[model samples]
Target: MHLVIVTAFDYPDGGPVAARHLALTAGLAQEGHRVSFVMLHQARPPAGARSNPAITWTSIARAGSTSPLAWRLTALRRLDRSIGSAAATGAVDAVLAAVRDPLLLEATLRAARRRGIPVLHELLEYPDVVRPPGPLGRVQEQVFVRRHLPAFDGVLVISGALEEYAARSGVARTALLGSIVDTALETPLDPLKLTTTFTVGYAGSLVQEKDGVLTLLRAAAAAAARLAPRYELRLEILGDTRPAAGLTATRESHRLGLDGRATFHGLVPHDQVRGILARCHLLALPRPVSRQASGGFPTKLGEYLATARPVLTTAVGEIPRHLRDGETCLMVAPNDEGALARALVGAASSYDAAREVGRRGRGLIDASFSAPVQARKVVGLVESLRGARP
Candidate 1:
């Protein structure tokens, strides 16, 4: 099988899209499929991208692709050039778009349909509701949802929670694709076992409302002050934030005197994540975002589990259901600083038993979230979509 995956984010960012795409495509190719990526931007693939040995990348646009008139025109040209001799004419067995950018999804699907091929819309994020209909919103929710949802040979639902959302929204052929973890990138490690110097890590984006960066920062500051001598606590926030959204959070972090205690290793590469996890006693992400806090499985939870690092996340959303608490990963209430601090201590205090907990957590992932498992399930899910056309 030949596959094409479309995404809006820049490549190699190692966020959810990159992680799942890398794992699933590589696993599929390993299982005898040729895979190519069509990124909205020229997101250069990660350095060591060899899951199937036949995997490749083609850039459609860059970050500024969504810019105003000048850049949008340039982006379309770039898109033409990127796909001109290759993608536009390239022969692929199946073209799959697994993202939220409806325009790209529709354009690619329309092009693929012209060739009489299967177009699988791997639903990553629920249809973008933030943006209203007008210009391209002309694609009514029914038209967009029904247009894209039912047309695909299959639909890849990221989580059961997301599947339920789509089902309610009328995506008939959706399947719970869950998520995939690159075990190669995030192999299970011995849980950080130390009687001292307990470090909590948040190794992803820095979006304030969604990812709960502010909550994590304040909790870390409070934990730093509270858990200091007892646990030798430090917060290693390993990602970048949206300064353009206004640097209010950064200013608050500085104001709260988290400058030295909490190290912000802005945007570490994909491979380095596991290495950082080895140093982290517990992976901490207290997301307050409605989506995150409500229940959807944030991809980081999978990565943390894959690395055999005990996790510390909020008790919101489907997270409690997907990730077993106290067994697979620990949980704290969303944005509860005191509760978060207590979980940090409890995780560290129980560090002896917690080590096995981390190993078992990762073993559970190995049993479930490995690349091959996820890809095979994704293929079946897509195949099911092919059969269950409403």
Candidate 2:
């Protein structure tokens, strides 16, 4: 199939957002599709971003935040020419506007409509779920629920709950694809490769929405105070650090006298995280209530399990369905300092028992989370659209 993927989220800086698309393009290309990734951001799309030779990329720099009047108009004009060029000969099979931002979703839908292309909007998170901000933000959110949704040929949701939620909003053709990860690269590391430390780790943006970062901080403090004097809990955080979010993540570390004990490895490239997972004993994050938590599959969760590390999470949303507490990991309530503390203490007291949990997690990843499995499922979706005629 010949395809064009439109995304509002900028790839290079959006971290996981960009990486996922790169993975998808590669996966689709390997499956024999001609793919083009079009970013809403204007910067030169990163060179060699996709491994699949059949995949290409395009970008439109939103001159003023991608939402402002001038920027939106300019983008639409550029998009008009681009889509017209792609479909001029009627050769394109479909268009996928992976809707991460609501405002741009409307534009893409309108453009895809003008071009007479089948469009699929991947709903990993919703406008109500993200709750962006201000009058314009609310307008965009409502637009997604009221207008943008109905414009697409089909809707792709990452969770069963999300599919039902979309259905309630009168969305038809909604399908739950769950979330995806390249699982082959995610297999557990050799036990001998890991250098054990009394450590608890969390990776990804230090943003407050996730909730897991804070939970990990409190748990560390509790573990430090409650554990044997010889067991010093070390902290390892990976991902981007924004000032607003960093203030909180760091404040707790200082108050707990964990300055020297904690290490913040900021935004290391995607592959570097896998290597860090090898030395990690436990992956901690309890994002119980975030929109992403409830509506999407976290890529890191699969990676952690692949590393065969025991996870201490709230197990809410897709996390619970994917990770079984006691069997594969330990679950605590979200944002509960006391519960998180207790879980930490328990794990510290019985490191060997915790190791068993890690083993189970790795087994789960091996059994169900392989990259081929994820790629094939996605390919199946695209294939289903192949024979439909206008």
Candidate 3:
């Protein structure tokens, strides 16, 4: 099947979103599906960006000197033209969009309707769940969720919570496509050797409310205190330090007396993350319990697991369903600094046992969450949608 994938992620080197799309599209291409990846917001490819010969990449640059509404309409017109051109050649089987804008979604539906093709939405998170919006944004999201979402021919959700939400929102066809990683790209770390410095690494947004970076910081401080004179604790954070609001991780680290021990590598390219993470003793995704946490799965978790590093994360969302507490990963309660600290200390103390658990977690990802595995589900969904199409 030939598929047109529309997304808002920056192409080639844009962080996790771009990585996720690239992995999925590469898998589709490997399955003999022609993929056209259309970037809705990126103007041009990044410097030193590499191309995939199997997939075609297109970018819809923002129009100059126009009102916000006019820009959206212009972008929609460009997208419509792209879709029509592909449909005219009988090359497009379906349109899979990972877009959040309601106007764009509406325009996509109208364009696909005209081209006699079905449109599928890749649902990652509810708009109002993870990031709370203003009043107008809230109203817009409500309209998008209740009205625009159900208009799609099918919806691909990333987590069980989102699948349920899609069903409740009246979506007829829904498929769960969780966080995907190309395990082939990952080289699991060899058995950990006893080291004086144990590093706990985290990648993703540093937002305290979203990723619980502050909690992780507090836990790291507590764990460091507990480790005392035996071992030195180091915290390595990757991603943006600026938060949407509240205390920044850097500031919190200083306040918690972890200024010397914590190192913040702000926003590196996705390709370099694995190499950096592999050097760490343990990886963490201490996401606190919230509506957003429940609704979405972290893409970084798959990447962390691929490194075969003991991942310490909370039992929230669909994670508990896939990973066993002591068997696969070290599970802890959300937002609990004490529990997180204890878990970190335990993992650091029992390095050999934790390495084995990390290996099992990696096995789980290889068996289930790998790019090829999830991409097959997408192919199946596209085929079913094509079959149902008149």
Candidate 4:
């Protein structure tokens, strides 16, 4: 099958967003499908990294425009042309679009419908769930989920939470293809390669409203205070640590008296993330439950589990279904700093058992959520959609 995947972000950019898309593209190509990755935003390919010939990468939007409205108009116009061109050339059987912008989604759907191509809208996050939550988010939900989503031929959701959301919105054809990771790219480092410090690493945005990093900080501080003189809990946070909701992760670290214990390495390349994770004893994703979390799964969880490192995270979203507490991960209730601190101490006290638990998580990924496995599932979904046609 020939497929065109449209996304609203720059490609070859190191992040879970790009990683998941890249994995899916590679997987589809490996499954003998001709796949083209269409980026809604223009980006330069990473230096020294060659393009994946199996997956054609292209962009419909031009960069360096000063006016937001002008760029949007231009991109919408280009989107129509691109979809028409792909259809006219008879090079694509279906179109799969993943974009946060409701306007972009509407444009893509309109263009694809005009071209008679089966379009699949991939929902990664719910519009109602946004940081600094307000009316704009509700407006997006109205436009995208309530009004436009059901019109698509099919919907691909990243989590069961989004699948339920789609079902409630009258979308009958929905696929729950949760976050994916290339297990081959992420393997546990040798125990001898461990970092000198007892590091607990968290990757991704430090935005308190989104990831609950502040809670993790408080828990870490509490755990450190309790475990003082026995073990010093060192935190290495990779990714953007900038302020959101009036304070940054670093500021909170100081407020909690975790001066030297907490080290923030603001955004690094995606390729470098695994290497950093390899240095940590455990990975932490302390996201609190919210409308946002309920509708999506974190891509980092897959990557973290792939590293075969003990992960401490809250039972939010579809996480409880995938990761069993005390089995594949050390789980705690969302927003409970005391529970988080206790989980941290438990992970520290039972280091060997935690390593075994991490190993089990890696095994689970191999059996269910590896890149190849997810790619095959996506291929199956695409096949089903194609077969449904007359």
Candidate 5:
């Protein structure tokens, strides 16, 4: 089968969402499907794209102006044309779009209908959860929940929580196409050897509100002060550090006297992330309670599990449901600094046991969340949609 995946960002971009798509695409291709990616707004072949060799990328033209409105208009026009052309020329057999913009999604549906092909929407984030707090957000939510979703043949959600959201939003057919980790690429590392400084790793944005970067920093500082003699703790946050939150977080770290204890490796390629994770004694995913947190699962969580490292994350969304609190991964309440510090201290106190828990987390990934596993489910959904098309 030839498949086209539509996204709101560039193909194989440096982020967790792109990582999820690339992993799924690789799995689909490995399952003998030719896949292509169509990016709506941004289109610059990521410097180090890890997409499968069989996966092709199509870039749509964009407006010269940098304004958000202009970018969207140009993106919609180009997306409709590009998808329609591909469908008409037999370059694609089915459409799998992961777009949040209503207009871009409409364009994709129109293109699929033009060729009488099946189209499915992949819901990574519930729009209502991430939308800005304003009337415009309500309007967009109505458009997505009432207008766009039911029009599609089916929906592929990132979590069971998201599947419920889709069902309530009037989507007739929904599948839980959860996040996939490329365990083959990111095999579990051996138990980390004791070093002078215990490294706690985090990968992704420093978005203070959503990812709990601030919380992690404060917790680490508190933990370091308390456990000064036992083990020196350091944080290695890897991702794009250009956001304003990064600067603010850095200032806070210094204000908390964690100047040298916290290191930021800004925006490395996806492939190198695993090597960095391998150096860490523990992985931290201190996600706070937010709209995105409630409806979507983080791709980094899957990767963290794949690394076979003891993970410390908040009990938000499907996290606590999917992973055992004391068995697989350490669970802390969202934004609870004291709980996070205690979990951190506990992990350090029983380092050997935490390694056992890390292996257990990896076991869960192998059983249910590996790339091949989730990709087969996604391909099954796509095949069903294709078969249902008249």
Candidate 6:
């Protein structure tokens, strides 16, 4: 199948969204599917950014637009043209869109409809989770999710929660395409090797409300004091330290007396993240229980597991369904600093046991969360849609 993936994900080296799409597309290409990745937003690729030769990349920049209205109009026209051209080639099979904007989503549906091409909406999270919408935006989101979403040929969801949500919203066809990682790229580290300092690493957003970074900081401070007698504890955080809007990790780290022990490496190249994670003795994703946390699965968790490093995370969302508490990873209750701190100390104390858990977690990734595994589900969805179409 020749699939067109339309998204706002930054090209080359962006964030988790980009990483997810890249891995999925690579898997699709490996399955002999041709992919055209269309970027709706303009982003400057950072140094050391790399591209895949199997996929074709296209950018539709909102060039010289002064206002939101103007940019939306320009984007719609350009996207329509782009889809039309691809449809004219007769090689394009379907369009899978990861766009969230209601207006743009409607435009994409219309464009695809005009070309007799089916459009599938990719649902990553609950509408209210990510940058929460305003009153007006909420109204738009409701209309889109309830009325517009069901109108798509199918919906591709990233989590079981999202798949159920889509099905309840009257979407006839829904596919679960959960958190995926390129297992081939993630080399597991030896669990028995001892480092001078026991490092707890976290990659992704540092926002308190998002990933519960403040809770993590407080827990780390407590863990540091307890681990000091046995081994020095270091905290390594990688991601955008300067969020557009939210609580910053650095200020909280200092307030919690972890200034000297914590190191923040602001957004680096995507390929380098796994290597850095492998060096750490432990990885964490202490997301608090919230609508956002339960609705979407963290892509970083798959990467962390792929590294075969013992992960300490909360029991929220679909995580418990895929991983066992003591078998695959160390699970703790969300929003509890004390529990998390204790879990961290326990995992460090029983390093050999934790390493075995990490090894099992990597095996789980290969069996369930790997890109190739999820991509096959995607291929099945597309073929079913094609067969049903008159």
Candidate 4, 105-213: lDDT as tens digits: 8888888777678888777787556412577767777777667888877887888877887888888787777767666666666662233346799998877878888
lDDT of 2 by residue, 1-390 (tens): 777887666654466556566555655665666777665565566645655567666666554464556655566667766666667644676688865456566677778777667788777775576656888778877877787776667666767777877787776565565434555445566663223357777888687677567767766877777774757778888866657787777776788778888888877776577777666677887775866677777766766676777788786787787777788888887778789888887876777788889889877765665544555565565556655534
lDDT by residue (96-199, candidate 1, tens digit) is 76544555556666666666656666655555533356766545555667666766665676666667766765655655656587676566775455876888
**Range of the 10 consecutive residues with the lowest summed lDDT in candidate 4:** 43-52
lDDT of 5 by residue, 1-390 (tens): 788887776545547677887787777777777777777666565655544567777767463556778777877777777787666545576788777777787888887788777788878887776566799888988887788888888887888888987788788777786668777777898889765678899998888877999999999999998777879998888866777988888888889998888888988776677788888999999999988888878888988988889999999988887988889999989989999998888888888899999999999998888877887886677667766766
Highest TM-score scorer = 3
Count of steric clashes across candidates, in order: 6, 4, 0, 0, 1, 0
Candidate 3 overall lDDT versus native: 0.81
Candidate 3 RMSD to the real structure: 2.3
Clashing pairs in 1: 11-43, 41-61, 42-61, 294-317, 295-317, 295-318
Residue 159 in candidate 1 has what lDDT?
A: 66
Please provide TM-scores, in order, for all candidate models, with all chains considered together.
Answer: 0.83, 0.85, 0.93, 0.91, 0.90, 0.92
lDDT score for candidate 1 against the true structure: 0.67
Q: Candidate 5's C-alpha lDDT? A: 0.81
Error of 6 at 188 (Å): 2.7
Give lDDT per model, in order.
0.67, 0.69, 0.81, 0.77, 0.81, 0.81
Pairs with steric clashes in candidate 3: none
Model 4: residue 1 alpha-carbon error in angstroms: 2.0
Q: Which ten-residue region of model 3 has the weakest summed lDDT?
A: 45-54
lDDT, residue 214, candidate 5: 91
